[model samples]
Target: MPHSHQNRIQAPQLAAVVVACIALFTDMLVYGILIPLLPLMPAVSRSGPAATGLLFAAYAGMMIIVTPLAGRFVDRRGPRGPLLAALLGLGMACLLFAVGGPYWLLLVSRLLQGAAAGLGWVASLALIAAAIPLPKRGTYLGIAMSMVSLGTLAGPPLAGWLAREYGHAAPFVFATVVLLIDGALRIAFVRPVPPQADDPATALDVLRVKGAWPVVILIAVGSGVTSMIEPILPVQLHEALGLDSVQIGLLFGLLVIVAATLNPLVGAALGRCSPRFLVFCGVLLAMAGLLLLGGGARHAPVIAGVVILGAAIAFLVAPASTLIGVVGARTSPPALGGAYSLYNLAYAAGLV
Candidate 1:
């Protein structure tokens, strides 16, 4: 468990965590919403799927490449700067989408958005880890993580409805408004409480921890394997089992919701007991879920797989994050952000 001079939850830190949740939700929601439309953008304009795919690829690829540097910056400066930058960049990306800009401009916007998101996402976790006590960290992180489900739950249907009712640009405008508001809240209130004596180290430091590199490899492989499953599972089910799209969405959505629901419980268990053991178990759970997912036995089997995977993710992700915080506090405070950045990078690299 990570010990801080701070005891219990402070008001500002709580507020920051809430704001961070909102920010993460909005950013992720925008990404989710944009993904469905990326291929469509070319059809709407002179550019085609190839061009739009380039833009999407640029965003994702650039984000991966830049994450380590972004993590280092957040480690040095704390969350405020990166958090604000993320909001601003997201807002600009929304505006660019709204404008239906030239391909080059769109590509630039995506790169900016990705870099900003990487920074904010890592920094927000670092801030929360710093703010919350070790015992309560999992529960709080679970709560924060749930907000991700909330955004995802809302984003797809909301975007569809807006596009149906108000036209294509409506979703972008709506997301932009949300981003702006989220940014304002973060900037107005989410300053880091104080600088702590976290260690300053380059990415190489992550390699020095005896068992840490294995965790990274596990996360990367897990993320890569899961990433392919996540976006296509519902569609694959709909086609394979003749289920309705809504049902597929529900099943897929439930996976995240379940993960969010379980995170705190799993975290609390780790807090009370052995974190490393839980992490290992969590990884095994994920692998088991993957095996189930691969079976494609029946609708029930697939749903079961999704649920198990969700539970596995909840168990693994929250505790792993908390463990990183623990390591950071022990080694140096600033490394918290860097640790998370490397984690994110490993996940992203796996996706690629």
Candidate 2:
């Protein structure tokens, strides 16, 4: 290929990666921002914690349904339209969250956000696969996952400070502004690559690939174990160790910090090692961490478990998608979108 042609290809791929990272960041940021604000909101507070839990469930539930459909849509229509639509939906959801009327309105906002999440994730991952070469997929996916981890780490503290100093609506407004800028950037620079004609494998065909089912199972089990910890850990700390809210917060923060710090390293490793080996090691580490958590009545053991579990999560998460992408690439007819959709679906189901 000519130098100019190479530049053209690389430019779009780079833009696609950037767009995917930003989209994933925005999705996680909005999600994390809601954690603190929901309990404090007047409409939500009156309904109690169960309602708030339901709100979270609503998002995951929609994601479980929408992701596979979004993947199929991307396969048929390319990612640009669904990506743009998701951004638009996310913007609207943010606007609704900021406005804050009835409790039902909040539910509506969450539902929209879930749809956006589903579309955004499916489109973004599919776009990444389409844009980047197979060997580099893990590295770029790691970068994208790192952005998500950072968002999760940053969003709650930022939301709490904003809500404390400003008002309940302030964080959502901030999110709205950031999302608008992100959407504008997408519109301006992120052009979609056409779906490859060679990738004719349907979702069912993708599922039949030898290694794919095991990868999906691993994703689900890993995600389920990780998700279980997030809600249960603070309670365990408060009751078992008599830690105050601030201490609990710091501990959770440490977990995210460890995971975020290690994400890029794990991602880089995925490029060099067999993903299956990394995943197997990760599962073993996770089991050990869980054992520690179960037995650790004291502080040191608990902290050790937390650190080990965080590392396990990083190992599991960074490689699972890469492995799926790799398998899809090797298929008789590559089914990148379908393979990714199943992975996303499994992860979302695990979260719920």
Q: Which tens-of-lDDT digit does each residue in 1-352 have in candidate 2? A: 5654543537767888898899899988887777556644678657765776677678889988888788778877888888899999898998899877588999999889999999999888778877876546556865776787878777766776777678878889999998998888778866757765555565567778888887787778767776666545555665689864445545656667877777668878987888778888888989988998878889999999988988888788767766777777767777665666677787887777
CA RMSD per model (angstroms): 5.1, 4.0
Q: Kindly report which residue stretches of model 2 are placed more than 4 angstroms away from their true locations once superposed.
A: 1-9, 39-50, 99-102, 133-139, 229-251, 264-305
Model 2 pairs whose backbones collide: none
Weakest ten-residue segment in model 1 by summed lDDT: 328-337
Task: Estimate TM-scores for all models.
Answer: 0.72, 0.79
Which tens-of-lDDT digit does each residue in 142-218 have in candidate 1?
Answer: 56656766776666556656765787788899998888788789878887644444445544565465667766775
Name the top TM-score candidate. Answer: 2
Local error of candidate 2 at residue 50 (angstroms): 4.1
- Cα lDDT over the full model 2: 0.77
TM-score of 1: 0.72
